[model samples]
Target: MSKQADSSICAYAYCSHEQTGYEKHFFITPASLLQHVQKLDELGYFLEDITCMQVKEGFLLTYHFNRWEKPGRLALRVLVVEEDKTIDSISSIYPGALWHERECYDFFGIVFKNHPSLIPLLLPPEMEERPLLKSSEKLRDLYELLPGCEQVLHAPRDEEFGQFIKECSQKGK
Candidate 1:
């Protein structure tokens, strides 16, 4: 589906530490989650949203970004099976994704490749099981914008950190 029609795609203020141009609207998708990260590495877009999703089949890995050198917001996503919840680490590209990946692993049981250290960032040492997979209530609020959604600022943001299952539901299966 086109991002404009997809409720999972939303427009927001793209803020980043890098010195970029004016913020631009961006689309979010489970399919493009991973591709966008790879694109950012190649295109020099600053990291925007680095989070994962819970899908019926499994999980969706993503990294959102705003282009500092260009003019656009980028969102990347990748779907992973429950049995093999893993993906390549983007630390090589963004350097900062290292901690983000670790946080994903700590809470959602995602495995990152070639990470210098993928230790727990927000979970206790005794918490062995994946917290996000444990319950549906701990999901992030999923959202997408309709075309011409100039009133994007009114949407309520999901602040809960343990909303893994909610992220996956945006798949619209």
Candidate 2:
């Protein structure tokens, strides 16, 4: 999907830091990943790390970022399916992503396009399979791993999520 469409289809979901380990969880697309990350960069958020997991839908890449002034972390997620296992390199915005990206590549076999060096960081160059990837039957949806999302992932009302976000925003203030 186009970046605009990907973003327009979903709204940001707020999570409690004390209860969920993060303040906000955003579900974005690979096409829109750079811009969302660029905005965070402009706001002085630092890239903590990049992690990846195999999900029933696809490979879910979670980019974790934080700021010294902020009290909690924020996660930006992009789902990459088997047909296209690539994402834009964030090393340009946050140089630290260079190493983290390499690690993700090493295990999950994700291709970070335009990366300075896409070589393996931990695995052997001859490794044929992505060690972190599991068989199809073992994969699970991203929502299952997310706290509170399980309660609402199947909820028929957007109002419920909107209200949760509003409450979280107010509590943060």
Candidate 3:
């Protein structure tokens, strides 16, 4: 895992393709998402999927991409707080995202701002409750499920993740 390659995308740390099956994984802000995604489109990556997960911190939206020639996956992750369940729509860049985004909306109640026809895809229109949301007690921090600053089969403590992030940030200086 390494720091972000450029400023356009905010990267803390990412797992290697050999280790995680992703060529690169980046943690970015919703503000910078479209610009970076446009770069990926220009680089010939096709949208594979967009998945949403509820965590202790908030909602984690991961967008997966890959190129036919390269044959490796890449991910751009953004954290949206439970308070503001919104982010810009990438359907303009990748038309296929319409379905994935809709599924996220149907299942998680995530509002994809500027998404054209942001309606239920799998669930019925009258279903007011999101099926995937867990109770607060069941929600786990992202570190428990994902690699924080590095990969480990076991979940790392929050302090470990915080220290790792700090150490990695110092390296950039």
Candidate 4:
């Protein structure tokens, strides 16, 4: 696990020799999202796709980047709080992200800050409700959804997750 000077940007132990998928998955704070994506761009990672999932914690935005020459993919996951469904745009670093971001916005209602234009990509302008938002009762734990897979909270540090877990534990009291 590696981290940048900014504690918000952290790389976890998602990668392993036996793993056949992405090389790494980094948890990034909303503030460091742009910088992290920019660094990946500088390292020659091409934007492959951007996927959003409505999780119990919030909205999980995963930016998939790959290098053609090296042939590996790295995903940067950013958790946007439900109340603040926004994150910095990586369109400046990877122009292709523009469309992907727009699509995410259209479906997840996640605003891409400073995006050239954040109009809906797949939905009509008249649409107001984001169809992707799931009800709390239907929301499932990450582990339950993906059996046998490791689950890592998208917090900057494990301690932060610990705090959140503690708070959640006390909520029923």
Better of 2 and 4 by TM-score: 2
| Quality of model 3 by C-alpha lDDT | 0.74
Worst 10 residues of 4 by lDDT: 1-10
Q: Please write out the lDDT profile of model 1 over residues 68-159, one tens digit for every residue.
A: 54445444435566787767777877788888888889878888878888888888877898866745555433332123333332331222
Q: What is the lDDT of residue 52 in candidate 1?
A: 69
lDDT against the true structure, per candidate, is 0.54, 0.73, 0.74, 0.71
Question: Which prediction has more favorable TM-score, 1 or 3?
Answer: 3
lDDT (tens digit, per residue) of candidate 4 on 1-173: 22233333224533542343655565656776776666566566788899999877788888888777766567777778889988888888888989999999998899988999999989999999898889899997654653333345534543433343355346531
What digit string (tens of lDDT, one per residue) describes model 2 on residues 31-83? 77786777677666899899999888678888988779755677777778878
> What's the TM for model 1?
0.57
Which residue pairs does candidate 2 place in steric collision? Answer: none
Each prediction's TM-score against the native? 0.57, 0.77, 0.77, 0.75
Pairs in clash, predicted candidate 4: none
**Candidates 1 and 4: which is better by TM-score?**
4
What value of lDDT does candidate 2 attain over all alpha carbons? 0.73
Put down candidate 3 lDDT per residue, 1-173, tens digits, no spaces.
33433333222334454445665566676777887788677667899999999998889899998778746677777788889999999999999999999999999999998898998899999999999999999998777676343332122233333454355356542
Summed backbone clashes in each candidate are 14, 0, 0, 0
RMSD of each: 12.1, 8.4, 8.8, 11.2
